[model samples]
Target: MLKKIDQAALFLEKNQQVFRCPFCHEAMKAKDKTLFCSNRHRFDLSKKGTLYFLKQHVKTEYDQKMFQHRRALILNGMYDPLIALLAEKCQGERVLDVGCGEGSFLHLLEQQATLLPSVGFDLSKEGVYLASDYNQKHFFCVADLTNLPFNKGTFSTILNIFSPSNYQEFARVSQSNGQVIKVVPRSGYLKELRQAFFPEDLAKQHYSNEAVIAKFQETFPKMERKIVTYTFEIPENCQHSLLEMSPLEWSVTKERKEFLQKNLLSRITIDLEVLIGRFSADNMKNM
Candidate 1:
């Protein structure tokens, strides 16, 4: 399955220009059609219609089962409002999704704007495989955030949703007028799971709002932040994936999982904060 996907990805790279090397962050040159660096580093485009730019191997916490769970929850309309909000806010011809798992948001964006061209990347090869299967038209690749394998100023807009941020890399690839939309979990994002696992410490050490704001401020000077909160009734059948996609999955004891399964509620809250910012070269002085 992976080999087939890689083949398809290589086919898609035919007309694409050699941008930056995902490993050394150096400029890449086109040898025939494949991208190669002076350091003798070579990365071939997959035949399946995507790029394979992952040079340094790193284990990802996400897996097929976790992404499958996330797909179920997202398709359940739990985050539809957030998706709509993102679709409305983003404006550009080309959009890149960093840490885009399974291309759910890309699917949502396609539904909203069929004309928009989008690309998604993730560290997890499994996730990229699934994303390519989900949508063959839009490009999906197994790439890293810290060292994106694209040319500088190639993207008009970039998105990081419930994922890590590499601001320097983001700034390097994004156009001067481009915007970076970051979706973060707000307070009580997964309250039910927290309730089940950390009942004893209900009020302590939640997802930090201050930290998110400070981090965004540190990265971009001129930015706007919006908080979005919504309630969804999670069905009994969907509880497993919802739990699996969360950190609570790792922290929960076996007994707690059983407990959550047995007493899972049909409703939960999906709260998020969308931080939208435009890069300003002058902003670097603030740092």
Candidate 2:
């Protein structure tokens, strides 16, 4: 079997055409484990096996521990339904997961479907580290969504799963006949956790997607939103991971977090809207 580094290096080499220099915004190619541009701006793959393609390194609360738990939750099949739906909706084999934390969803989808050139990018190096160091079956790099380092019209499909994205960038990088699938959380997504964190705050307990929907409709003339609401059963051992992985827990008091950790909740809601976007022919050229 190829070593993880070799595998990762090869993957990067195969798709280097899509990568561009963060400094000069020019095409980049892999050169002995380093990505180089015509301008000589370079980026070396780290020991963790991820290339930092962002203009500047970013720091976020998304750390290794959170990715670990998120990985476990995905493995436990908590999001299998969502995965199945994504697999069905995904149009092309060349898929890019923006904000792909820990490589769980992309890796799993690759298994479910014969997706070639499955690539994952995240702004958080910690998340990319967890993904790269753990497995090298696919591409995982530290890249910001706002300033994606990709050639124009590269990907046939772009996936933004509960992550920040620049719609204009998505339109620019995606092929003329491409699909943009974005998963945004609905009001009841992790309802129990929301209640646990802010039990008394009625406004905090509820969520809405009206504005988000309007924006998606505005961005993609041909768009569809599918509401995915289901209750998932997470084993006792894995419940703690769910708590640790979610940003919703960030605001919770330490006491509440600790309390919820001990008294595990076996079932949780997985409410989200999967928005599928396809740009119109008229807007494609302008975009």
Candidate 3:
């Protein structure tokens, strides 16, 4: 019988044709604990049982502590409705999560038996480690989105949620008829937090998705966007994470951070737009 790690590895092996060396852009073969290419460039399998496919080191505010808090919120069902919608629209034998943070979202889908083979990749080692440690049913990797390691037309569906996206890379790795699902924040997202952080700066309380939407529209030929907004009552104990889980709080001062950390939000607004679409004619020209 195969261990969970091997099972996940088998998923990679089955799709090895789509994987390439980050250094040389050559085909990579999966061995026991590493992936090697003809050019002799190699990548190691992490101790956490996931792969590391990056060409360089990464620096970011998304450390282990931050990912821990975000994972906690996700496990608590903070994004259940959104996840449900994603799972429903996502139909494919294999699913690839681009910029998948901490792996909570995909892990939850695996628990709910909504995935065939879920593979998650993020630039943050901390996030990928959290995901790999939390669940063994799916494959997680530390990867760079700008130059993905997968071959042309690898995944039937790709997901980009609350993370940066590279349309060109996405198109190169996705199947000819692949679907891309992207979630962008609306102005009211975390309105309570905005209000608390900037009590006086009225402009700081709102956000806009105009540029993001337009970019997505330009990237994909056929696309539609939907607005999902609601006021979710916050549990008293969960308020700390609700504030800390967002990157928006990274710029906050120590004094303000302590205040928000101690205080609780009664209700938080969840405003977001879900963009479901396909690659444009120009992108599909690669097919």
Candidate 4:
């Protein structure tokens, strides 16, 4: 079997047309385990077959451990319904997962549908690094959403799952006829944890995706929305991971964390809105 780096090189060589230099916006070619642009810019793939597109390191609020917990929670089927919905909506020719943390969504999406060329990128190197280990077939990269390192009209589906979005860049990189699927949280999402962590604060206990949904609809006027809401029973071993997986607990007081750490919730609320649509022809024209 080929090493991870070799696999990535082979994939890039065949599909180099999808990529663009982040700095110069020039087309790039893959050779010698590196990507080279016409402007003499080069990006070398890491030993693990991951690429780093950021010029400087970014400090994310979550660390490698948090991502590990997130992956564990996902593997335990916390978001299986959401994943299934996403799989159903994805066109899957050349899919790009923007802000794909740990690459679990992309990996599972491919498993559900026929395998296709897939790429996932995140601003956190830790997250992207963990993502690379999820599947050798998928390309994982540390990249900025605002300055995606891909040519225009490259992907058939763009996934923005519970992550930040750059609609303009998303529209720019997507095929004119392609679809963009975005998942945003609903008010009842993680309400159990929120109620536990922020009992005194009502605002923090509830979420509102109205602003996010409005923005997504504004960008893709023809979008369709699906609400996936359910209660996932937390397994004994996954309790801690579920608690630690989200950023909701980041700012909680030490006493509360310690208490919750000891008394984990029995179930979690998975409330999300999955929006699917195409970037209008006018949007593409503007791009």
Candidate 5:
């Protein structure tokens, strides 16, 4: 088997045109195990076959343990229905997952549908590191969403699922015929969990995607919107993982956490809206 660095080197060499230097905005080329721009700003793949586009270490609330829980939930098929919906909307040969936490969604999407050259990047080093353990057919990197390391018109399908987005950067890196599939949580998403933990907190109990939806609609006026809502029964093994997987658990009180951990939730509401649209650089410029 090829060494991890060798695998990443091969990918970078084959797809060098997809990238530009995050710092100087110059085109970059892969040389053996390293990627370097014309100005000699270089990045190397880690031993685990992942690359780093981040200039400095970024501290995020998402740690390795949380990613582990998230990955467990994914592998256990918690997101299969949502993944199927995403697969149907996917088009073109290249897919880029923005804010790809743990890389499970991208990895599973390819598994459930046609194989494509997929790339996933996240701000969390732990998330990217865990992602590299997925199929070698996909590439994972630690990158900033505000300053993506990809060149213009690189990806045909861009996925921003339950994560943050940079619309300007998304428009810049998207192909003319490309589509962006963004999934935002609905008010009912994880309603049970929220109520169990923060019953008195109305703001925490309800979520509105109106502002986010409005912004997306403004950016892509003729976008298609689909609401996918379902309740997934939590398996006995995944109950604890479900509790700890989301950022919601981070702020819960100690008593609530302990109670939820022991009592466990039977199911979770998966309510999300998948917005699909062809990005117009002009529209984004106007915004």
Candidate 6:
């Protein structure tokens, strides 16, 4: 039996810290089942226990179907080692995931340790809804990374795994002593998918390792990078889901899909680069 989160009560309890009115940057405080700002701005919490405070809306590429596919793949332990490595890196005071699709990583973290406090935000409403259903204790919201409705210096640790990066916004919301753990896909990731999709050209696209180093070096004085690679079998039934989980689905035509299904590959490579950066006052000054 899963506990249903009362969005209103949860919002009231955590709204002040979790949300800030984008209009005035005033903390939203719950009063009489409504969230209000000091400047008299008010927003209602949804019946389902979530709030929509996005300044603007943008269509997300990852949708319900994509998340469903990802959920299946993740549940099969495709990225277990990466999750474990991240769990080891996190000190877990106040963790925020920028693009937490369906709350898989957050759920994994919950299983691994008693974290301090965790919150996940994503552009997809469907993803947030699904995440909330998965765990009531962990807060999940539909929000954008480009313009997060959070006060500066809020999060202790930020996680951006295989998602877009808004480093400027991330820096603004992160505490001076906070750290960011970002995971980027290496060239070898999903090599089999590429092989199945484009058998003729198997040339691996080289990753820009120097570009990653240079970008983080501009942000943090102390940064560390680690490479993690593993192999996972994608069952025949799960192959369609895995195909749908990636952009390759679009790139690979129906003929290709049918061809791959006929001669389906059983396993694929999973390679990722994890970058951890610690922010300092000096680093802020440099920026």
Best by TM-score: 4
Model 2 clashing-pair count: 0
State every prediction's TM-score relative to the real structure: 0.86, 0.95, 0.92, 0.97, 0.96, 0.89
RMSD for each of the candidates: 3.2, 1.6, 2.2, 1.2, 1.4, 2.4
lDDT for residue 80 in candidate 4, whole number 0-100: 89
Which order, best to worst by lDDT? 5, 4, 2, 3, 6, 1
* Cα lDDT listed for each candidate: 0.74, 0.82, 0.79, 0.86, 0.87, 0.76
- The window of 10 residues in a row where model 5 has the poorest summed lDDT is 278-287
The CA root-mean-square deviation of candidate 1, after full C-alpha superposition on the true structure, stands at 3.2
How well does candidate 1 score on lDDT at residue 117? 54
Query: Can you write out model 3's per-residue Cα lDDT over 1-287, one digit (the tens) per residue?
Result: 56556665675676567688877789988777677899998876666777878666888789988888888777776777787777677644467898888988887666554566667999888888788765565688888888888887888788889888888788888887788889999988888888898888788888688898898887775797878888777666677887778777877788988887667776788888999888755667743
Write the residue-wise lDDT of candidate 6 on 55-161 in tens digits. Answer: 66667777888888888888778889998888887745678888898888888877776676678888887787677766666677777677787888888889988
Q: How many angstroms is residue 24 displaced in model 5 relative to the true structure, after the best TM-score fit?
A: 0.6
Whichever of 5 and 6 has more lDDT, that candidate is: 5
lDDT of 4 by residue, 1-287 (tens): 78888988988998889899999999999999999899999999998888998888889986899999999888888888888877777744678988888888888788787657889998888888888776677798999988999999888898888888888898889887888888888889888999999999998997687988898888878889898999999989999887788888788999999998888898988888889888778867765
The reply for model 2, stretches above 4 Å from the true place, is 133-135
Which residue pairs collide, candidate 2? none
Ranking by TM-score: 4, 5, 2, 3, 6, 1
lDDT of 2 by residue, 25-66 (tens): 888888798889989998887766778876666788888888
Winner on lDDT (2 vs 5)? 5
Write candidate 1's Cα lDDT for 1-287 as tens digits: 44545544443455254267776767776544366777878876555445678656667888888888888888878788988888787644578889888888888776776435567899887787777765555678788777788888878788889888888888777877678899988787877667767778756437667787788977776778888887798866797677787556786678978887777667787788888888877653232
Is candidate 5 or 6 superior in TM-score? 5
